[model samples]
Target: MVLQVSDSDPAKWNLALNNARNIQQDLGKGNVAVEIVAYGPGLGMLKRDSKVADRLAQALDNNVDAGVVHIMKRQREAWAYVRP
Candidate 1:
């Protein structure tokens, strides 16, 4: 699944990250395909002083430590963010 985070808000960052974590927890980890792709302001969560840095670290750890989820990516190369 593709989960996109486009805002700089830490709350939105958490919502997106939590959705990934919660999904991994609810449905067995590594069982399903998941991807968190960030773009524009959403990339702030990767900065040194981002408010969601801790949670971001945990998410990274979740992948590095256990290899539960798939790799997290920064959107680029003409990514499609659909608008309805």
Candidate 2:
């Protein structure tokens, strides 16, 4: 099962990512498929500029399907209120 968490808070985003990694780790000890997508403000967690990118990189390196979609300039302008 894939849990889709959509939130802007970095703390919550980090927690969710870690939780996903832990679950994937345990499940992979046996057999399971898992992935995580961080979009919107949550994308900040995986931002190319964020310090946490290394940790995110590590998770993705471990097979977590971590993905980030570039918010286009138009989308950024339209969603400026929600993005940091």
Candidate with the greatest lDDT versus the true structure: 1
Instruction: Give per-candidate clash totals.
Output: 0, 0
Taken over the whole model, the C-alpha lDDT of each candidate is: 0.61, 0.53
* For model 2, the run of ten residues with the poorest summed lDDT: 75-84
TM-score of 1: 0.67
- Model 2 residue 30 CA deviation (Å) reads 5.3
lDDT of 2 by residue, 1-84 (tens): 343445657566567667667766887735744445555566666666675677677766432333333234324445321221
Instruction: List the candidates' TM-scores in order.
Output: 0.67, 0.55
lDDT of 1 by residue, 1-84 (tens): 557676788888877877777778888787855566666677767787999888787776422221112223213433333211
Candidate 1 Cα misplacement greater than 4 A, ranges:
61-84
Model 1 pairs in collision: none
Instruction: List candidate 2 stretches off by more than 4 Å.
Output: 61-84
